[model samples]
Target: MKRFLAFVKKEFFHILRDRRTLLILFGMPLAMVLLFGFALTNEIKNAKIAVLDLDHGPHSRQITDRLLSSGYFQLIQNLNASRDIEPAFRRGKVKLVVVFPPNFSQDFARNDTEAQVQLLADASEQNTAISLTNYATNIIQNYKSEQAPPGTVAPMQIDVQPRMVFNPELRGAFVFVPGVMAMVLLLVSALMTSVTIAREKEMGTMEVLMVSPLSQLQILFGKVLPYLLLSFINGCVIIALGVFLLGIPLNGSLLLLLAETLLFTFLSLSLGLLISTIADTQLVAMFASLLVLLMPTIFLSGFIFPIESMPRFLQFVSNIIPAKYFIEIVKGIMIKGIGLDLLWKPTLLLLGMSAFLMAVSLRNLKPRLNQ
Candidate 1:
């Protein structure tokens, strides 16, 4: 017990002594959560569009007014002909181009309407285009319904109700906040440890420690244990940021959140140890960590993009990325309020991955010394 206490004390000293690592371990998670929560989102807003109102009547004007008032599309240009829309879109000045047909209001008033408006959207902006198209369709459909004569459509209608599932708000931030935590923590902690270890080699302290009487496990723990604590604290920092700074709710069990957080911390540290084992230089370790860990964790982890919708090969590849499992665990706990009973599969995968990384790292680690 005394020796264990001494070991833990040394571990704390190792972490607190390094100002750079301390700042990153505590600061990066908070920074990333805020950035993702505030700056980045799946929902596109205030999208700019150009209009070619050819009808030149109440119908076209009403359509323009609807698009302008919907808040999804912003009308930036008003052109007289449909031909000008091509150049505007070609020059990338607008995301959508609306063309209202001729005599649309006259046709409507005569009850001989066969009017249609063309919505030409930039397919390059796929997600934004889809959202705008959907909004336009819904608005047009509502307008058509309103155009129906009184009593032609039911005065009042009874409808079956549909309520939201786990996330009623559909805020998207609820999903991203937890995911960004997993991603940023993995990047910051894993890169920090790997690069720090490689730097020790560059500076020759690794040799000095090797020559000492410290066991390999002690030396390993002396490095990673501190990062583990820092990572755990960083988890707390992110939770606080999400709850207070971002106003993201923690709807599930705190104990579950902590348990999953510690698991994720170990998972990332294990990957860091593996990276340190493979690379002798800090630069290589950093590049490898960023390329291998940071990008995939954000892109492939079902954090922002749905894994099921990805290509089959990508779905297979994402399964091996430990960040995926951790993100699922944290998101499940924080956003979905899911308990361990429902999350055992991902939890086991993370634990297994950590165990595998430890074995591989220890095996790669020179019991005597690195040449």
Candidate 2:
């Protein structure tokens, strides 16, 4: 036992003495969180909207005020004719062009009179078009409801307006690209980290380390530190791609993103450590990591499917997966732009899992090679 204690001390020295590794340990987590946080959300604000108000009457002005007051839309143009809409849409300054057809008030003169507002939105941006359309519809409907019922109202009415948000103009691929990056990053980091220590053993390096005076805990730290850093770098790569190339939003607090990412990185590294202790070779390690971390995180993490829509069993099972929490934190910070108060639950869960993995790893480490 004394010898084991001495060994642990020696291993710690090797790691602590290496400044490069320690720097990476701290740097990687912060970088990855910021990158992934921005990459994983699609909610857009401050999108440009164009108006072609042919009515020039109280109704058109009222509709315009309502849209602006909602704080969801910004008007880009006021056109006297409907023909100007297509040209504006082509100019790309307008994602959605609103056309209040001539005599819009005439239709609204009766309490139930039918009015048609043309919302020419860029279908290219699916989510933006859809979101703006819904808001505009709701605003118009609310205005109509306030008026007395006109002579037998038209059974149906449609109001269309196109104002986009974020990547306004909902380019579908633009939506999930960030979340996909988070998934890929977690997989790359977790899988690589899981196999690394096992690879050292397969190459006979672990035997030499085990025979050294350094402690097992130190050895474990040294191994995990490298992959943790690497995983963080992978996360950074994902973030850069999502932000610069994909134009994803980074509206939330950068600090919160980093803190959450660090917790997740610690959890992933510890999980990799647990896998290393159990596996005999790098291939087995790789296979095991994929089976344990890859499959579960992907299917259960709400990356592709809505968590609420999932089966109750799946919903319950997701609580145990570290990736689940990471996904939530990523979406919450990046997409929702929410703060720590709302995110503490997932953050705490991740920390608890990391501690559990680290504890089990320590208990599992054998004091001697033969044991």
Candidate 3:
């Protein structure tokens, strides 16, 4: 019993001395709990909205005030013309737009059927669109009931015509396809590259490669290029399956989508190379890939949960996640059919992240190559 206790004590001390082991054992649970606790939720809040109150009457103003004050939405734009609606959605500025037609208050007071409100929603994310329409409808209903004269049946009706844009049917596949593409491409590219390089280092063959005529950049590229080609092929296959089998539309330019996919795959590979520089073993590299890449892609990338619904700090943290930008780019192209004119921001961000990651990886790899 004493010898067994001593062995247990020694193992505990060994774990304490190994920082990576300690982090995996203690830090990961805490991080996962905090992230999942805040990030995973169905409720939506502070959703961006636009208002086109053509009526510009008291009731129109009142409903608009109620919506903003209800704490469920934030007004990002007050559109001036009907033509502005498409530009608002294409810019990703607002998720829902509340448009009160001309003479809205007068028609409602007269109990005319023309007292209608149109809700234009971006249904690329199905659940959010439904939730926003529901909330807006409820608010309008409450206003109608309260405005009715006492001891009388409700005399006014405000028809809410919720028109879902981009995806009128609100299919779940529209949302998940982009998310799955991001997650799969990132995992295949980063995990494979990290593991391959870690294996070479573990087997001592990396030393042999370092001594070869190939330069450090060439050595690293040679090790990773095959995986890059494989990842790109895998991305293309995923897109083909999504379009043909799942019935997800490829509405945007195929050439542009392919180009963006290649960029994202390269970014993921750069991240993997960066991970390999930090992890000396295959197990560590794999763990780092999952810990650093997979979880963030799933949670922080706004893949499953709406980022606006998460806590403020987590939303800020999500800005740094490459998958967040890539997923947006994919959805924008495939669902909204928007071109690079509107997508330049996310595309530039992906390029910047790729460049940064590659620079750091090359810097870290230089000393190892020399040794």
Q: Could you say which candidate leads in lDDT?
A: 3
Residue 3: error of model 1 in Å?
Answer: 62
Write model 3 residue lDDT over 1-371, tens digit each, in one string.
99999999999999999999988988899998887686678788999999998999999999999999998999999999999999999889899999999999899889656489999999988899999999999999999999999999897988889999999988899999989999888889999999999899889999998888988778899988998899899889989988999888888889999999999999999999999989899999999999999998988888888888998888898999999998899889888889999999999999999999999998997787566
lDDT, candidate 1, at 125 = 31
User: For candidate 2, lDDT tens digit of each residue in 159-199?
Assistant: 45444434444555554654565566566656776677777
Worst 10 residues of 3 by lDDT: 34-43
The list of candidate 1 runs beyond 4 A from truth reads 1-162
Model 2 CA lDDT for position 170: 58
TM-score of each: 0.58, 0.57, 0.97
For residue 122, give model 1's deviation from the true position in Å.
28
lDDT of 1 by residue, 221-255 (tens): 89888888998898889898888887766777989
Question: Which predicted model would earn the best TM-score?
Answer: 3
